[model samples]
Target: MRAVIATEPGGPEVLTVTEIADPEIGPGEVLLDVAAAGLNRADLLQRQGFYPPPPGASDVIGMECSGTVAAVGPDVTGWSVGDQACALLAGGGYAERVAVPAGQLMPVPDGVDLVTAAAIPEVAATVWSNVFMVAGLQPQETLLVHGGAGGIGSFAIQLAHQLGSRVVTTAGSADKLAACTALGADVAINYRDQDFVEVVAEQTDGGVDVILDNMGAKYLDRNIDALRTQGRLVIIGMQGGTKAELDINKLLRKRGAVIATNLRGRPVEEKSAICASVVQHVWPLVAEGLVQPIVGRSFPLAEAGAAHAYMESGDHSGKILLTV
Candidate 1:
């Protein structure tokens, strides 16, 4: 099997596609002949030596993939050889073959193609678990998302909008904001030249009820400012550096809460539950075309390095994929 391996952590140039032994599965797992894999910002972090896979996980960079089952291990149920599926993985999605826990697999949605299904799992699981399950966003509430044109953001926007929340999102450019609006974002703020805090305040009575934030410390203070009383703030990424001062008084006055989370390092049981929630709650929306896969571009598996470069360029509007 050919896999993208990092020769050394530094830049996209470090990634090399080379033949590697096919993975073997244990009980409760299934081996997939990967059709396509999704590229995430975390992959770029791993390539730059900023993030490493959890203990015992494959060193390969990818976190989600769409593929067909080649074999099922002992104790696995409901999946059989030749079944088409997409899976959320801890690692090893950058390879031609990967072993995924049965609980992590989801049947391809009704209208998605094999390669496009690769774009669904991670974004679906992330947005559903964080924005819906964790934050408890309600139909009549308002939600704000950072980086709305990115994979997770695009999905969050669509899902939140369809679920009946008024959605506000931030992107870097006019065109990106327009794209976000087309995807159901009620209000799009250009982060480069606008203050999202003010925008949210003006759009909603006080502020949004929930905020799905990825900027971490940089937005912590303002995120608090942007939230309504009793609001929930879920932070899933730290692209904007770590560590900042928190105003306990502000949080106390609002009676709000902040939750910081990461999907990659979770225990298998938790991941399995999230995957199940995604399938049950989110898949139906996808099947109905109320929410859709947002694939920005795809590269052949061997050209993963170029994919990484493209992602780093920050020009893409949605998920980037590497087709096997």
Candidate 2:
């Protein structure tokens, strides 16, 4: 088997593909021959020596992938050799073969290609779990998403819109903003030039009902300002830095809530439940063409380094993939 690993904690240049032993499946796990793996911002953080995989997870740097089952371990059922599925993984998705907990495997939605299925797991799970499950976004509510041109943001925009929420998002450029609008964001702010807090306030009449934020401390104060009374702010990434001051009085005045979460570090039971909810609720929208997987680009597995470099460039939209 072949896998990608960072030669050292550094830049994208440190990433390389090399021969490695295939992962052996444990009880209740299935072995997959990967078809493709999704690239995520966390992958970049890992390459730079910032984010390490959870304890006992594979050191290989990838979070989600689509693949065919090659074998099933003891205690695993409902999957068999040659079954096609996509999996949300803690790590090892960058490799040609990976061991996946059976509970984390999901069937590819109808009308989606196997490789494109690679693009769906992580983003779908993240958006659904954060926006709807955690924050309890409802129909007729307004939801704001930061980094709207990126994988998680793009999916959040479409899903919220399709589910009857008014969606507002922020992107860095006009084209990216346009893409967000096309994906059903009611308002797309150019973060480089506009004050998102103001736009969100104007768009929703007061402030948004929920905000799915990826930028951490840099947007913290403004995010609070952009929330309506009783609003929820869900922070899943620290791309904007990790430390900031919070205005407790402001939050208390509005009765708002702030939460920070990590999908990668969650327990298997929680991940499995999220995956089950996604399949039951989100998969139908995909099957009906109400929501689509937006794959911006793909590189062969051997070009994992190039894929990481491209993600860092901030030149692409939606999900980037490594095809095996």
User: What TM-score does prediction 2 earn?
Assistant: 0.99
Q: List the residue pairs that clash in candidate 1.
A: none
lDDT of 2 by residue, 178-260 (tens): 99999999899999999998887677878999999998999999999999999999999998999999999999999999999
Candidate 2 ranges with C-alpha deviation above 4 Å: none
Cα lDDT tens digits for candidate 1, 206-253 = 898999998999999999999999999999999888999999999999
User: Cα-based RMSD of the predictions, in order?
Assistant: 0.7, 0.7
For all predicted structures, in order, the TM-scores are 0.99, 0.99
**Per-residue error (Å), model 2, residue 101:** 0.5
Clashes of 1: 0
